[model samples]
Target: MEQIIERIDQLWQQFSGQAAADISKLPQSGSDRMYFRVKGAEDAVVNSAIATYNPHIKENETFLSFTESLKAAGAPVANVFAVNEEHDIYLQEDFGDRSLLNELEEKGFTADVFALFQQSLSKLAHLQIKGGENIDYSKCLTAREFGKQAILSDLLYFKYYFLDTLKFPYDKQALLDDFDALSTYLTHTENKHFMFRDFQSRNIMVKDGQVHFIDYQGGMLGALQYDVASMLWQARANLPEEWKNSLLEYYIGEVNKILPNPVDPVMFTIQYNGYVLIRLLQVLGAYGFRGFFQRKAQFLTSIPQALKNLSAFTGNRKMGIAVPEFDKCLQFCTSAEVMSRFEPLRADESTPLIVNIHSFSYKKGIPSDPTENGGGFVFDCRGIFNPGRFEEYKTQTGRDKAVKDFLEQRTAMPDFLNSVFDLVDISVAEYIRRGFASLQVNFGCTGGQHRSVYAADALARHLRNKFKVRVEVKHIEQEAKNWINP
Candidate 1:
């Protein structure tokens, strides 16, 4: 560690002399690995730091390039100072002593934190790597594979501390079964994107009132929901339920602003639940790795919390189909029914989790009953279904088939008329039957110009008695307005 420190000092010397003075007060690393920050005495140049350790594997210029790209893309990545590729030493910018977690710990985040992260999300959303190749997500293993490692850890932890060390009965097969269910659920992704793979609070640095990322060598192209889940579910910074849902939408809204097309929030959430479950699995593995292998008993205490979160994910209606499998595993490992058997649990019902579904289409299509719309049932704990109506497309030449269908139903148009309706429908259903709490409905039109917007207004009008409707008459050719149904 001393030799590595000296090498890091030499690297800092490459910068201006003022940096040397500020480097002295740096914290003694909490871990065996050494990290120190060297700031410019005047704060004129830039605050910087070095992370040094014996390379368990190795580091290289390619690694440097990855970090550099992250920095350029507005990602909260440290700038590369100098790298001893063989030793895994990194000298980079020091964003200074605030991580997102730190702010939450000390002076709880103001609205500014949300704004700051929004900017960061925007940067990440628009990010496209130069030289055109996307990030190599393949290098990072998937959660399915990673979950197995967690199972092994849980098994070992149970056997050692919980069983042998604590003299408790260890159920091995139950754990294996739970892992199997978790692995399968994680494999089904509704959407995918470049992921920070491990975007936990510990890894996010808040220096100079801005958020940045550290320990990002494990980055990959994966699900967008993974980072959001990590941020919301992080042990150190567990967010309020309202805050979590709001921030989740904020991130999605930011992402949609940059994408060529909008994303389905319901679908993203379904995927998010799966990612959360995977995260729990990874946490279990990490805990096992730390507790049983490293002799750190503190991590063992965290296992139950991880299990609890895992249970929450499984019991989620969006995640219901996968829950039975995951439940079996939980039952197997803990030898106690870990998953909450009673759901729409009283706590969940009282929370009033509201999710709105928005759909739009260009052609004249009939809209589904908002009550039946996937997003409809979110209003009621009991399941509700809305089959979006659409004007039947005419197959016969010059035949008034579509017109005939519309006249028969007396419905003007359909909201969310597009190829992705399958996903949209599923989302609405899940929101009602599973994630029930409250509901809002949105209808869109191609250009929000005509059909979709009109259909949306009608549905809002139809559901006004039971729902507080926000009906938008979006027109591609004109400004949009709300047609509140009385």
Candidate 2:
């Protein structure tokens, strides 16, 4: 760590003729690269920049070369400010912490956010088309170009790491034949544009509400649709179907603008769908390797979402080319019985018992406990003043501020929750100490839309924050309402 700081200090002095003020390490991501924010002296001309230390000198060189090439092509990429004598440590412009994904989560999928997506896709087309010119292919990290070899590498990655690990029954030789056919078909794309190997929301930064991209070190010469597939189908983003179609059309339109002659829409659609399948399988392989094989909790949580994506993709659409064995394998992978294996762990057999809490209508009966133990506390919130009785609060649920304030101010809900918290805290502490697994808590009321929902949400939040135990919350009646309205 000290050596890295020393290197950054040296680079700072060499570049800006000033001493370093301080260096702070940034959070690590999936990649092996280490980043630090280097601050300059109070009055120094050089402001703060991100300094990266990568052990892979070849990848560092590729990144530096790509940065220069892409920047000259008018792409919104981070500029390399300086590099040490070893070429392993370099400083680049820091584009702050906000990402497009963060923005989408903070704000909903509105016009403003969609506009950003539009701008991003427009820039991406330029990055692939204009940025492909005069680039040295020798500097590519792995394959000089994305072709049959690269496609097979991804398919084989899925096979060995994910598919084989699942131990699902299949004709191995037949699947291999299908894989070869699929790869050969995808390689016949009309144009070989620059492929940003891992183009997704997290890699896109939003500075002053404008989009800028980072982390293109793995880029290579490839078809345009691969990157498009990567962005629109990013697992966590879970973009709405309407938004996905709109954005895809928007991207193709942008690509047509820059092309000397527009690409054939029919052929482009076929190839694009093929690439989507390729990207989905590649991501599933990644999640399986990181989650199932390595036992990382975050990656494990993402499995169901990815499975959901695969299910939706295969449900209605078919690739232009048929690989029957691959289709059957995909069906098996997405089957309900198969997906059940990847569902997140239930608390019953695990340490630090997670309390599953729910709000439900008494009329609909209480929700059944999913845990094997099957019994815990159930509080009736019908005794409290009903927020749903008031017309103003009828449409609102517990999560809304108006409903919360009303429950806390106009009623004795606080006293009710205070007593409940005191009771639950006892069991929670003892469970943690004894390493017991599951607990259930329920709140019920007449309508289950306001008071019960509020109480359940409150208890879930309190338990999570106070005791640091996992808490899963469900609002049965409210969820039904959302389904009806949504």
Candidate 3:
């Protein structure tokens, strides 16, 4: 990462003929690409530039080409400044840190947030209608267009990664047949355009009282409803039902003004709902793959909310098509028992307990409690089999699938956590009874990189699920050197 940053700064200087005064990293998204802001520039890389480092050369080219074409069409896309000869790093207009998601979260459901969304959605309608005009489909990362294959892939992604992992009983073949039927129905939508496949608030940058867009590298020729659905029905957003209806209506009205052939308001909306289901299912699949399979805490926390959203959508709205088998699968996935499998029993607002779980190296010693109440639990995790001992797992941390699998299957991690949970449960109950506000739990190991991380995550998960308390898990040594969540 240090090497990438240094190289990117050099590239920025070479392009602009100005040494980078400061270069700061941006938060990483789901993609492997890394972003940085190189300040002290005079050009329209927004007075600086967003330096992007991505290893996928082809993806970089597609993004550059799309940016060129989209900007030419008056789309609100970032202007590309320069691309390195290798096509691995480039600079583009910077929109700063504030995003539409940040604004929505900060402002709540006020009229201000509504207007911002309307502004973004209005831009989206124009981008969809104009951005794809004569654009080269061959540059797309995967499918040239969001055809039936891509649609089915999303469905199967949900089935294989999310549904199959649940160990729930359902007619597999029948469910698949239904998946085909649903995909076919969605693929037949007439209003295809430049689909920003990940058109969510996080990607919509808010700068200088306007909305700009990014992360459309996955864009392709597809339905307008897909992008709209992706944004409004985003599970984590938990947008109001009323807001969803109003915003959808607003977006259609905006699109009608720009579209050569105006969309039928009624039919367009029904298709949008279908795309909404597809978007929800696709998100669950992503959460499963990155959370349940990869052991990422952030994604795991979102599962409960996603399940609730799915169930509500199914219950309240008619999907305009019947797929009994798909509906059966949905019922199973969104059932109370199934949701309970992933959801933490949230403590009442009145409950004061907040568990802080830490993973630390013995060399650095056990993590000290920051609060005035200094005494807390610190358990030695050295007894567990160390994945760090083997060369195969040395580079992988507890967050990786291979290391987590090794720790769970080959080590005594389960039994150790089971014993730990039994001991902690008593104290947690006692603490809540006593109206205590804070509980700190620390796990110590030889290196703090592998065993301790896994144990700390386990304990946090256990406490959140069983005790219904807030849990904050930190990798002490890993975080010290920025080793966590990279």
Candidate 4:
């Protein structure tokens, strides 16, 4: 990987005629490709570019072709900068670290973020219509078009990856027949445009105070409905019903204005809803494959949210046609019997131990234990250097970056927490074996704004990760006012 970074930096220097200062590897996404943000020593050609190392030569070729087409059609997409001789390594314009999903998650559904959603939909219409005009189907990474076969593939993906993984019983032949029926109905729609196969908030980046798209390598000619369904019905985003409805209408209106002839809004919407069901099922299949089969904790954790979103659609599935077997599979997936496994473990009488954690100020003394069993550990954080002494972090709590950095870098907080974790682990394990219901661990500092709060939160995280026993945390000082995490 270090060698790859060196090679990438060398390539950037070769292309830009400027020495590369640093090449930092980015986080791994769903795809197998690795990425890095390459910074230039001198800004000759460009200051920063996203360096990609994908072994799939064909996929890389398709992405380059699509970007050129999307760029020509006024789509908000990054430009291809350079590609290596092997075609495996390439450089593209960096849209910065902030993606639309990052914005939605961090700031939530603010007015500005909502507008970005709308803006993305409006541009999507253009990407599908104008940007899609001259796209050579021959250059597509997979299927030439998202026709009956393609739609059926998505349904089958859900069936094999998600449904088959579970021990759910349903008529296989009948489900196939239903898949054929559904796929045929969807492909019969008049509209065919470039469909971003994985169009979600994460793929859409918010750069230069505008929305820019990434990871559209799997794009193909399909109805606009599928992409819209992918974004609005994203399990993680879990967009509000009102926003989904508004965004869909807005997208359709944009499409109508661009196209030579307007589509019937009523019919288009019905098809859109059908695609919503398809997209949801397809997503579940992906989660199951990545989570259950691959044993990825991140994907496994997301199963509940995906299941929750699927149930909302399946509960009132007005698809204008019924597939009893498919419906049965959907119902089984959303059933309480299956969902219970993903839910947090409850602390019942027979369930053994529950650890109650608290952070308080020395001024307030130790917090009182709620349970009848009152014996536990109370660690003093006053010995540790407090960031509260600094004026810059005076208003900030332990959760804030400045205070957290101060505590972590300047003080012996990490060593202190490591020792605390060792002590807590013993009692927690023994308590679980002995069927102990409660354990109270408190951290007290001068103000509870810096040291104690950080320590308590750290210990809570440690316990949650190390043990299956239920853990509860309380910041008495923060609760008295409110918490701050930034």
Evaluate residue 370 in candidate 1 and report its C-alpha lDDT on the 0 to 100 scale: 45
Query: Which of candidates 1 and 2 is the stronger one according to TM-score?
Result: 2
Runs of candidate 1 with Cα error greater than 4 angstroms are 17-19, 22-32, 39-48, 51-62, 84-87, 109-133, 136-185, 311-317, 323-325, 331-486
Better of 1 and 4 by lDDT: 4
Model 3 Cα shift for residue 283 (angstroms): 0.5
Q: Assess the local accuracy of residue 459 in candidate 4 as a C-alpha lDDT between 0 and 100.
A: 88
lDDT per residue for candidate 1 within 414-440, as digits (tens), equals 222221232333443354446455454
- Ranking of models by TM-score: 3, 4, 2, 1
lDDT of 1: 0.49
Q: Is 3 or 4 the stronger prediction by lDDT?
A: 3
Local distance difference test, per candidate?
0.49, 0.85, 0.85, 0.84
Most accurate candidate by TM-score: 3
Q: What is the per-residue lDDT of model 2 for residues 1-486, given as tens digits with 9 covering 90 to 100?
A: 668789888998888888778887776676778888888876655688999999999999999989899999999999888998898899999899999999888898999999989989999999999997867789999999999999999999888878888788899899999999989999987789789989998999999988999999999999999999999999999999899889989899999999998988778878888888899999988988875665443465577889888898889666788888889999988999878866533334346577888898999997887677788899999889987877887777877776786786568887788778768777877777777778899999998888998899888877765656788887888788782222
Error of 3 at 470 (Å): 6.9
Candidate 3 C-alpha lDDT tens digits along 192-308: 888889999988999989999999989999999999999998886789999999999999999999877889998888888888899999999999887766655457678888998
TM-score of each: 0.56, 0.73, 0.79, 0.74
Weakest ten-residue segment in model 2 by summed lDDT: 343-352
Supply the TM-score for candidate 4. Answer: 0.74
